[model samples]
Target: MAKANKKDDNVVARNRKANHDFFIEDTIECGLVLKGTEIKSVRAGHINLKDGFARIERGEVWLYNVHISPFKEGNIFNHDPLRPRKLLLKRREINKLEKNVQQAGHTLVPLKVYIKHGVAKVLIGIARGKKQHDKRQAIKEKTMKREAQRAMKI
Candidate 1:
């Protein structure tokens, strides 16, 4: 019975700037704790992860700056657009992320948000900030790769 789902099929929102601003060393999929109205908004693809980042505090991961627009029909029970949401992960995984983030220049960034099997999940990355030169290098490499692909097509 159940049909297989392809990657990116259920992606609701993505932080495209995450890759350009930082180098993602590792990523972990974690569940999100959202209110009923928030979930409704997410299902409608009204979420933004552009300025989102996660922090480990008091042994729990809290996501900040991700904007989940309120449900249009949820007049009285609408959730705040910029509320900090809790991220669910195993204790071991949380510890690992905490340890990595303790290193200088490293931080946690929310990469994308998607619905999997009716549950909302977030892909968080352990990233290190990229310098100006590093960002330029990445851009250059991307342009070269695109040009190469065009040449191959010709």
Candidate 2:
């Protein structure tokens, strides 16, 4: 099935810093392997993707540092907040991503977590780290654009 677009409203969490710290080259949405309580927590918008990242390990993609808060009524069955989760992606895509990430300064980062058709999905990006100068330039451009827009409004 085709992946959902960026404008989808079901987004649960986003890693805003990823945009500022890395240049996203490509994006792939993969299904999540979640437990009962974990899904409940995610549906409740209790997920944090700020520190999350993806790794290709043993021919599979694994997600780390994605926090899914425990379900309030789960009692003893509440899921762990920081457990590593598996991501479902095709073998070909996985291989390509692995190859790209093996290069210097390239990494896999989780861009966002969203619900599509009632199923949880994560949008992972193949990204390259930005230099300090590049980040400063980006910030400068953003400020300039903002100032220009504000000047236009008056």
Candidate 3:
């Protein structure tokens, strides 16, 4: 079977702080458990991934703090904005994430949420917290790179 590419057209929300506050080590894709209007709201690009995180609870992966806006046209079936969504992942992946998270300053953070193949998916990354000096160095390095690119053009 061939897998179809479903690139997102409109981005609902992005966790800009994630890149700045944490050094992302690895990322994994997980399916999201959504309700009626939730899928529609997400497809419309009305969701937020900032301050969202994934954690294993009772042997299951759950996402917390992410917001999916209610459907404009939805009435009684509108999904809650702050509801915790279950993540679909294999047992091995769950164990690996949990183990890695418990080591040092590692954590699981969701980077984005979008619809793919008529289903919702969350992109979660295993990250290590960055120190104050690390963030400053990152900004300096980024600025230097931009300067180099500009100089090369002229």
Candidate 4:
């Protein structure tokens, strides 16, 4: 008998503003240390990544400002919505991220949150803040691209 493979990589939430605000240079997928209720809330799509960022603290990566709403049934055992959560990554990968973040104008921004193979994960980007002019240029390019696609369709 052959084993059937299940579809993986269910995205729970995305930080749509991350790309608009920063130029993403690199991305890494890391696991999140979620409490019981937190994971339930995540599966229910009650998580927000909009204002989330990661910081290396004491040689470990910590995710901050990501909101995981309290579980409906978790009256007394619910975790704090804005609590800092630990991100799981190999030591070498953490070191590499630390080195990259030490460069000027670079920071770690959470791009999205997802559940892969029943485990919660976060996709973080090594990004640099974009200038006002750069943002305008990006918007212009996007509009041009959309117009071109529309012209081709017609």
Model 4 C-alpha lDDT versus the unseen true structure? 0.95
Every candidate's lDDT = 0.95, 0.93, 0.88, 0.95
Model 1 misplaced regions, further than 4 Å: 1-5
Model 1, 13-69: lDDT tens digits are 999999999999999999999987999999899999998999999999999999998
lDDT per residue for candidate 2 within 81-154, as digits (tens), equals 99899999999999999999999999999998899999999999999999999999999999999999999999
User: What's model 3's lDDT at 102?
Assistant: 89
Number of the predicted model whose TM-score against the real structure is largest: 1
User: Which residue pairs in candidate 4 have backbone atoms (N, alpha carbon, C) closer than 3 angstroms, thus clashing?
Assistant: none
Question: Under the 3 Å rule for N, CA and C atoms, how many clashes does model 3 have?
Answer: 0
Worst 10 residues of 2 by lDDT: 3-12
Q: Which parts of model 3 are misplaced by more than 4 Å? A: 1-13
TM-score of each: 0.95, 0.94, 0.90, 0.94
Q: What's the residue-level lDDT of 73 in candidate 2?
A: 96
RMSD per candidate (Å) reads 1.7, 3.6, 3.1, 2.6
